[model samples]
Target chain A: MKEVRVFAPATVANVAVGFDILGFAINRPGDEIVARLNPDITGLKIVAITGTGDKILPTEVLENTAGVAAYTLLKHLGKEDLGIELEVHKKMPFGSGLGSSAASAAGAVVAVNELLGAPLSRESLLYFSVLGEEVADGSFHADNVAPSLVGGITLIRSNESLDIHHLPVPQNLQVAVVHPDIEILTRDARAVLSDTISLKKAIRQTGSLASFITALYTNDLPLLGRSLEDHIVEPQRKQLIKGFDDVKKAALECGALGCSISGAGPSVFALCDSGYLAQAAGQGMQEAFALHGVNSQLYVSPINQDGVVIL
Target chain B: MKEVRVFAPATVANVAVGFDILGFAINRPGDEIVARLNPDITGLKIVAITGTGDKILPTEVLENTAGVAAYTLLKHLGKEDLGIELEVHKKMPFGSGLGSSAASAAGAVVAVNELLGAPLSRESLLYFSVLGEEVADGSFHADNVAPSLVGGITLIRSNESLDIHHLPVPQNLQVAVVHPDIEILTRDARAVLSDTISLKKAIRQTGSLASFITALYTNDLPLLGRSLEDHIVEPQRKQLIKGFDDVKKAALECGALGCSISGAGPSVFALCDSGYLAQAAGQGMQEAFALHGVNSQLYVSPINQDGVVIL
Candidate 1:
């Protein structure tokens, strides 16, 4: 194929108890990437970009997330001179904590891999995708990138080793996400966190994470809801997102199994047992945000089983 | 039934990645408690205590773990006036970090419940048993008590709420436990730990724990081994256990899946895929301890399915 277009879904990272370690992909509000072999170009170049309003995204090949991801993958394949032109369509808001950068990077690498006749395995593409993500946040974590690439719920054991595992998702598990119009920069959200936490709180967090994983394997929705607690990060970062507490309360009251800040926030996500409940929770969350005079967009989706797909 | 004699298996708490929240039961070296109706005694009494070798265990009803557990159960049921006599046979060593006190407490509750025609559900007995455990170590953690009472692998989500869940054990999973002939009090071991830990290390620990739980559910033994890491507590407590580093090294060298200090210290445990490998690893751990002029006892067993049994 001379050209390939792929859609990469947005992702929710942290998942309350698994800070910097767990994330899951959602089916909507994703990025689309189109990669084509350009004989006229000597190397990779960003030709066109859309959907990101006036929010200037770098178009330079080396500076852009899509270009950098494609470049990294091509360099890894010893095909750095391969002529490629890319178009990035950002369907999600930037710095929205919905893994916007990860979707673009994942979509780009996936598209480029298909355009190059799939020289590397899907798993082998994660490293380049993560390196591309590092360009946006300056952090080496892959909680966002892995789930967007591998699909479903992803647990990253170690970012240095790129050791990632896909956790089982319950059949009835649905998600409701509310992205408030306010933007909370990941850097600003992260800067509010403490360098150290009490050992008592740390143990409590581990218990929650362990129970949360067990709940997924056993299909125990109530246990999953009870264990979806963030004792360490959420307390510090919630202040960055306006009306996070009220939004979370509204989601839970509307039948969300659990609700918490999605990634660094501004966007809040909830898990529910049914699609109907997810929709209700999303509407409730939106109303709660409105109460705080904050406009928000709501998306209800099932856990995306297939992360990135060809369009 | 007028009388009942029951056995409660010893447990390995923490399990490397889940300090203060996770544990599993083993088949051998457990405490046996015999509870019988006594017309002469007006309340709970510790009639006899054995196997502890000159260690003065509390015989007072409120002070002894077995006595306290039985008393607590009877009190909760409004049967505190009923006459009951108990015989405590301690099969495991004290301060061995093998959940010795937990076994006694669990055995007592199970035996007394059986003697009373099983008035309480098995799940409801965890709280009384945990109260018994608190007499031994001033802390309220239930990692050991829950597993010894309920069997298999247990994850205690919240000790405050008594919210516990049993995790699946792999079919071929085997345990090798080595207890060096030294006493490391839980209090002293806890004292050496810092009140706080770096947030970076806590996140890493959470990754290991989440991965470990996922490995158990999927029966990925290699992944389990890789994720059986203790970054928070082990580093601080290993110095209290003689030959801990060498013994862990020897166990890993002998094809054990994972090895770490069990519970607080003095007792080290290893997980292996086969019974034969477990035995070999146990021997290697003992030999390594011998190099440090430490005498040790080795027990190799499968994951105990029935935590406490009536005889």
Candidate 2:
């Protein structure tokens, strides 16, 4: 078996009101896993597992995200009969909004593709990684995986064609992440959102999304801050998180551009102009959480320019 | 007496499904009238009239659109003590759906401002024109005025703030315009549209708008054509136009990118890729109208790069 290399990064989903549509990668590197082709094995299998959720499960193709990614890739490539051994390094926490499962899954597919000299394009692998997320969330959503796989803030115009896409990363922007010491299931969080939204609300959402894109292009801070508001989702989800308002207020007081629930909640992210402000916002959020009788950690990082990479 | 030069251009409104949100300017120039400040006149008076309905109406300060713009600027600048003489011209017919009122209003404001050495920002002047549109339409709507003043695809973000915005134009675009000799009053058209739209219909409208924006970004010609559809306004408004479907069919068959009612339109605009296609589309639409017993003229012009202008 020859050595394979794979890398994955953390991602932020639901960038403001663009629910299920917008996402981006963060500067901090995520988990990496490597797998090598083992020609002698019989059926599709995960010979080994590491990095994340390893204690909760075994090296099975059905339950494991990385294993599922490899299986799906093999199935798509018509090479399902080939056996492979995967080794993952769990660098980020499982409960964080940093797309832990996606990291593992993307890492697996990337490693396998690299070992085979890269047959699929980056977009194809992104699709493959999203399949792995379905095993964890009971639904396939690319809000997190696409940005982590592609790097920078991505607008998913449509998943089918993957033709209308681009990265709108504003220069000199920083991301401050505050992950509370609590676990909220993504499925449970998603269930609380209303299936119907008012036309007025929807119009506001569309206008803001357009403005956010425009601001990124124009590099206007105040306009970008205005676009970070979500009248549809954030108000309902704020109750799930302890001291969310205080943290948001603190971040705003500390000169953070905007703050909102990351992905499904329990984790919060703030946009800032510099590393100093990001750090301050993160610390403020952590302190606010502490006041609410929960210990939390913060990560002040820049926008991830490079997404997935092989090491 | 000081001479004031005011310029207004034609605007295409309701741009596809961006109903009440999107508009753009046209290269085909409209009326350009000069309002000269008069030392001999008192309490707002007009001195000269040329081109377009000039002799048909009162040159009273409150009645004339160009005169109203001059009054608005004078009022804002606190130079109301000085009397201004307005030279009015009507280059385009009022009911052509090319936003003749907006052109006259914007032209009036620009001419006055330019004569005054540009005391107000360009966007502010745009708002001044929007204000003048209220005298004719009974409400302030930036849909027409912004594009006329801005010279590109302008999206009205907010009228209260007077924050009219511009979007990037797609490349290799052609605009084929057909004017059927039919009059649809703005009031009648506005009355026909349902006050409230179904949620499903609204989403479809938004999707159409989003797809159009994405197509513009991706330079997807076929997709751009597909995205020109509108489920909300077109169905209700098409009943007013003579042989609307036939015109659309002919335009599409003639290699037009797409066709839609142009601003409460008796006129229709078809998008295409080149001059030849635009000309073909124009002729086909005219032929369709002729077959339906309606005489129509065609303008095979590209997307207007210049908004309102002084001719």
The per-model lDDT (C-alpha) reads: 0.92, 0.76
For candidate 1, lDDT tens digit of each residue in B116-158? Answer: 8899999999899999989988877789998999899999999
- CA RMSD per model (angstroms): 1.2, 3.7
lDDT of 2 by residue, A188-253 (tens): 677777666664566566566666766776787777887788877888778888898998998898
Error of 2 at A286 (Å): 2.3
Question: Per model, how many backbone clashes are there?
Answer: 0, 12
**Which window of 10 residues has the lowest lDDT sum in candidate 1 chain B?**
B133-142
Worst 10 residues of 2 chain A by lDDT: A157-166
Quality of candidate 2 docking, DockQ? 0.25
DockQ of each: 0.92, 0.25
Error of 1 at A161 (Å): 1.0
lDDT of 1 at B207: 89
Docking class of 2: acceptable
